[model samples]
Target: MRIFISSLISGFEQQRAAARRAVTALRHEAVMAEDFGAQPNSPQIACLRGLRESDMVVLILGEGYGFVPPGSTLSATHQEYREARETKPVLAFLQEGISPGPEQAAFIAEVQAWEGGLFRGTFRQPDDLQDGVTRALHDVTLANATGPVDERDMMTRALAMFAPENRNQVVPTMLELVVVGGPNQRILRPAEMEAPQLVEHLEQTALYGESRMFDRSLGVISGLDGSDLLLRQERGASIRLTEQGSIVVRLPLDEPRSARGFDPMSGMVLVEETVKERISIALAYVAAVLDRIDRTQRLTHLAIALRVAGADHRGWRTRAQHAANTNSIQMGHGGVQARDPINLLARRAALGLDRSALIEDLLVPLRRQYPTAN
Candidate 1:
């Protein structure tokens, strides 16, 4: 995430620097007016250009309204924010002690009213502003990766709910059942095998206990069903993917292309170009979450777990390296530990059968937000 820091260079310089460090600490690029040397264009033009390029904007309001470029009604800071809010999301922080001038206060009020812009509390210490920016960035990253309406987020939330010891079994089973054909295939679809037969197949593969697979598969079904990504044939006799599910699989909607080499009914395979594209997009989203592991360790852990499953399916080497760098998850023996961090965290949180609290904490909010999710 390239975060544009918009503020007056005079009074709020320290706060701006703090925000820059905070954003850099999270591994995101920070764009500030100070970083760019004197520009030939009007200062307003230069600032607005940077804001336009930014993924998100962070506005800091202090005692002064700052400069008003010739021929412009609003000050440079307010003008940059006004233009940025029109396109990108904005995060505004007002200083605590300094009373803004009338124009600045009015601009603050207008910013608070902007749709999609977030207004946070006033800041006194530089650390306060830093913390505010950090939290806001985390929320934005998480929301982008796993918001209520996001399909991948819904899938990840579901995967996090299963007991840690069983994730290896559960995730592979879900992937195999949902995705058909190709080198990365895991297991057969539910419709192809009866409950008894499915259990037998699991035993043959030595992947999971029949009973556990049965229980976990139901959970997967419920989550996907609620997300409208999966559908069961009359009376639950068989299961099939919804159109959204097809999208997950990277199956093309164009009839001729979809039918050319693969079975349209077979759904998305790892081989498709669309799957590659989705993996790329998903990696970018996961990167932001991974960057903030310091404050959001558990949620970041869950996010990596979800990504590892998808990465393994797609054979994404670069994605694996990125996760490993953050200590979120890894490859080889380290990878096993990465995937099963849930059980260890659970054990540390509590004893005996009550150890799922860690997972619950991360998932409960998502469940509430998406009440329809099982």
Candidate 2:
């Protein structure tokens, strides 16, 4: 596929070189379009026309590198998004650690509404650049193909997509998912999202622990729709529901192996022997996951991680609409209950998931980090 790089040419020199090499390594003919940076109005428009001819646009984001052009409102990257809105495709690669600052987010929210494309992780260096870009591009390709993408799938993929070393950032997504897998494929809806469904399906098939987690998450059928609940497939992902439309928690996932290493941060680091010394990163991953994960299994997974990290384990209580703070207090640690609907610890009610598989991903590392009592 033909790809175009729409970036400010002057200040972001290092980013430019990295982009060129990365795109070259990906074997796509690359275009710099430097004249646009010098004279953003006329020349940039001409460059955009050139980019319009390409199949995909790679937005390299930065701060103070103004290329938004006079009279026109959209930034260079945002404009390219519109350029491909009706046809072709595009993906944004924002700088890591740069949370959408107010003006930036307001500016982006407009383009995000205008164009529907996947924006991958924030990249810092050139070493992991190629892999990161490739992964993001592949996801964008999938998302472009899938359309809007299942919200849960996007975050699930995003958390795992980046270099686990930089696990400090808090990256979240739109929806929740209760996936299942084996013989048939399905996507769960918010109302239909039940942890029991996942547990029962895996049990009937006699699936093992890791297999259950891997397989169950793979076979999500459909999500419930209403006021405050949602579950969906992220756009552009190559997932197909069976013609029957039954919420059957059975089917093979496109990539099962990747799910094996699946530990998207729960607001904490993915700590283990291999992670070196990213305690801070782990802490961040755990903290973010604590807030991001709305499902019970994920919450339990969070609790397990906190415990393994040797934390003062505290069950999540929906103290307020805001966040779960350290100062607040709650009840129980072993599992869940039926009453706590919005309760993160209420495994069955909110997450609607069974005990083992849902919590397994977060717990396995804990087991590896700290063995159980005999």
Index of the highest-lDDT prediction? 1
Please state the error at residue 137 of candidate 2 in Å: 3.4
Q: How many pairs of residues in model 1 come into backbone collision?
A: 0
What residue pairs are clashing in model 1? Answer: none
> What is the C-alpha RMSD, rounded to one decimal, of candidate 2?
18.8
Expressed as tens digits, the lDDT of each residue in 96-181 for candidate 2 is 65565555677555544533212444677655555666776655444234233233442343233222222233232111112211
User: Using Cα atoms with residue i matched to residue i, what is each candidate's TM-score against the true structure?
Assistant: 0.41, 0.38
RMSD to the true structure for each prediction, in A, is 19.8, 18.8
For all candidates in order, the CA lDDT equals 0.46, 0.39
* TM-score of predicted structure 1: 0.41
